[model samples]
Target: MEERVPVPPPHPAQDVTEHVGYRLKRAAAALRGAMDRALREHDLTVPQYSCLELLDEQPGLSNAALARGTFVTRQSANVVLRGLEDAGLIVRAAHAEHGRALPVHLTPAGRQRLHAARGAVYAIETRMIEAVPAERLPALLADLDTMAAALDA
Candidate 1:
């Protein structure tokens, strides 16, 4: 038998390092890290904090609405709500008209925690964006809006 020759794989022609999806993923991961660090002081996970923020903003949001806003499943929302309730951070009351539905409200303690966490979040965000020039933020936000609109469309 003739000796076999080793063949190398062909290299791709275009640079794939800066693909849109990869950039988006990297940015999302970085943002998530900042948020996680900011919320850690309050003993809140990202999901828990997100749920609390939603409840704080909308006093009587239904579990379904909370889940929708937080991009979590109904079951996951229920779990988080239960934890918040156990922590004395939220109260769940039966809906006035919808017998099958439960409305979530932030307790006073929850409000205080959320207020404190908000400050931390703002500080974290400020630090995260400080490296960028102030003039670039409006454009960056606008680009994000444009991307969102395109995705929605």
Candidate 2:
């Protein structure tokens, strides 16, 4: 009788980490780390910064809208908003027409913090994009836009 031999499981034909999604996830994680470090001086987390930025851009935005813009659930948005309020960085005002909705507004202190964070955020972003040549930026942005559009669709 022929001796039987065990064969190890075959590895995947391709490196999963080389896929677009994997690469994007890895890049996002790295970017998040940089952002976290940059925001540390301001005592803000990524979610908190996002909340402040959104409120600064669109004053009196409802919690629902803020959640949508920040890509978080309403409950998660509320948590961030509460933290900001506790930090005296934001205030919630009753909506004019919607009894159930409240609009989030940045306080003067919040605006100041946001302003201080701007420079750090910009520096981090600059360093991140500096890895690619300036001429390639447009192409990279276009690719990102296309990807975003595809995901939206």
- Cα RMSD of all models vs. native, in order, equals 5.7, 5.4
Candidate 1 similarity to native, TM-score: 0.80
Once fitted onto the true fold, the runs of candidate 1 whose alpha carbons sit more than 4 angstroms away are 1-14
What number of clashing residue pairs does each candidate have, in the order they appear? Answer: 0, 0
| Residue 151, model 1: Cα distance from true site in angstroms | 2.0
Residue 49 of candidate 1: its Cα lDDT? 89
lDDT of each: 0.83, 0.89
Please name the candidate that would achieve the greatest lDDT relative to the true structure: 2
Span of 10 residues, lowest total lDDT, candidate 2: 6-15
TM-score of candidate 2 to 2 decimals = 0.85
